[model samples]
Target chain A: MIVAIASGKGGTGKTTIATALARIWDGPRVAVDMDVEAPNLHLFLAPSYDGRKRAVLDVPVVLHPEACSGCGACSRLCAFKAIIALGDYPVVFPEMCHGCGGCLEVCRRGVLGAGKRELGEIFWGRAGAADGASPDLRIAGGQLRIGEAMSVPLIRQVRTKANEMLAEHPGDVIIDAPPGTSCPALSAVREVDVLLLVAEPTPFGLHDLGLAVRALASGRVPTGVVVNRAGLGDDCIRAFCHKHDLPILAEIPFRRDIAEACAQGIPLDHMGELRTMMETLARSLRELAEPRVAA
Target chain B: MSLIAVSAQGDTPEASVDPRFGRAKGFGLYDPSAQYWSYLSNDAAQAQAQGAGLAAVELLARAKVTVVLSGSIGPKAAVALRAAGIASVEGADGQTVRQAVAAHLEMPQRGDAKS
Candidate 1:
């Protein structure tokens, strides 16, 4: 089963839930961190890997000044408006470019050419105890270059890797999605069988939780909520869930030990109750994935 | 000189406010008509197309809009617009389509609006 852990707001424990689940789940599970921009799961998992692979996104068409013939054909065919005609030359803005290749196709004089540019990198390897109770897990994630505006493409690439791993192993895969209801989050949610929305118990948390729930519903994915940092706010989250008939899978009480474990780069298992909660969550997820048994 | 088409609002106030074009004021050079600016529809559906890179260019060519007012534009579209002799103004915000056109027309020729 492909399970995606997502939240509308950042720092709501998405990676924490994903990593914790991976630590407890049996079998050859895969944990994929699709938050390509500022991927922090690596800091949590600390997977021992072979080597990292550079993931390249499509490069914009580059205009060649030496190719002669300043015909406006290239400009006329570029849909993105990435190319501009200036006097006898054309200017190409790389950042605005989506690398659609329209200019190359329309440039009769062959003034435009295709090139490759690096967008991000993917790190893959194994995590978990070498001889512990949990099965050895294959983990992979992508990290987009700082200040890179394009994230959907990199996230798509990371998801493709996750799909390949699942095809080979055919086990549960947990994806940690980036915050916000934008292109990157949408791309990450696509093709996932289920989504686990992690939110806190505050009013801000409830608001963002609604946003995430709406986003998931639009994506047509089965979604459940896990209330992290519970017992802090008045029962606004619980009240909202009760009114809306939204299922509350589990509520993790506010605990300093879990926070300290996270601060020290230690796994959630360091805290006994948190570890048990995550294990129970994993079991419920596995049950959801199983075919329904008739009464 | 390139024969360029700018939306009345993108070029001059009188042009953008003119009712002949359906009160449509924003204009940007699109390789085809798919990217043409239209105030009639809130959905920018006229601009969206599915295909490889070159089809986007064709859509711009068909639309023939010379410049547009947008919060953000991708580099590929910007490059295509420039090569087609289209001038793009950065930071165009809060101006009605007519006002934006008037502003573009009033600016001194900086050699950027060649098309």
Candidate 2:
């Protein structure tokens, strides 16, 4: 089963919780950092280098400018305006293209050709086993190339690569998704069996968490909330979750020691209380994934 | 008769020039030969979430506009305007459309003899 850990607001400790869970997961597990724009899970997981590959998207380029009929059909048909048919030929902007191939299909003259645009890189390694010992967790994720506007494609690639890695070992997947309820975040959680939304208990956190909850209200996956910095703010998040009938799976309280450990790229598995809490969270997550197991 | 389009806050030449090119409220178009002014509402481009500049450029291109005067033009819009053979003059903000057009007219024309 695949579980995605997401948050509506940044700095809500998604990577902290994801790394904790992945380290202590009882069975074989793969942790995927889907926040390609700024992946920090690597700092915590410390996955040794295993494999890497460049991710690309196919965009159309003008192949034949000489056979010109400046009909502007391709420009008119393009919803993105990535290509514009000018005086004699269409100028192509690969950055703006969504790689939909609609222009090529519309071009009767076959003026457009398939072109590849580098989106990002997908790299995988094993975390917690740099000494050639059995790895405690498999790590896989993607990083968006700088100045790349579109991150959904890279996030999709990370998810796909994680799944491919899982096929080799057949393990549970834990995806640390990016913040917000936008396309990149939604793409990370898409089709997952369970989603654990990591939320802070502050007013801003409550508001953004509501946005995320509303965004996923129509989704079929079972969702539960894990309130981080639980005692630092009021119980508004708790009230909101209770009003919505959403279960509170766990809460990581506001503590300086935990913050220091996180800052040092240390997992909470070494802390007694936090480790027990993560173990309990693991049980709850497994139960959420398989109701029969809990029954 | 060349046409000039000024991104404007309102429909008339008396209105202030809109500072933005992509999300401008509207355009006040002037035909120099006819000395006539017209308004083109840019509601569609203003409402577009992405590629508003390109959409606005497409609108001007469709209207056969030869010159665009705006405060700022985004990179994509700049490219599209250059491709369409339309000249762009930036930093036209805070001025009335008529004043902006008058100032543009007073500027030295290309290929004119030096004083």
TM-score for the A chain of candidate 1? 0.86
Instruction: Name the weakest run of 10 consecutive residues (lDDT summed) in model 2 chain A.
Output: A127-136
Q: Please provide, for model 2 over A1-295, each residue's C-alpha lDDT reduced to its tens digit, 9 standing for 90 to 100.
A: 8888998888898999998888888778899999999998888888887999999988888899887588888898887878887657887788988778888888888788999999989999987655222355889988899999999888878888887877788888899999998889888888787889888989999998999898754446778899998899999899999998888999888999888878887787777698889889988888887852233
Q: Candidate 1 lDDT, tens digit per residue, A78-171?
A: 5554565544666665554666777777777766677666777888887757524277688888999776678887787788887777787677
DockQ scores of all models, one per candidate: 0.14, 0.58
Candidate 2, B24-84: lDDT as tens digits: 9999999877988999999988877678898899899889888889999999899888888
Native interface contacts retained, candidate 2:
0.39
Per-candidate Cα RMSD to the true structure, in Å, reads 7.3, 3.0
TM-score of chain A of each: 0.86, 0.93
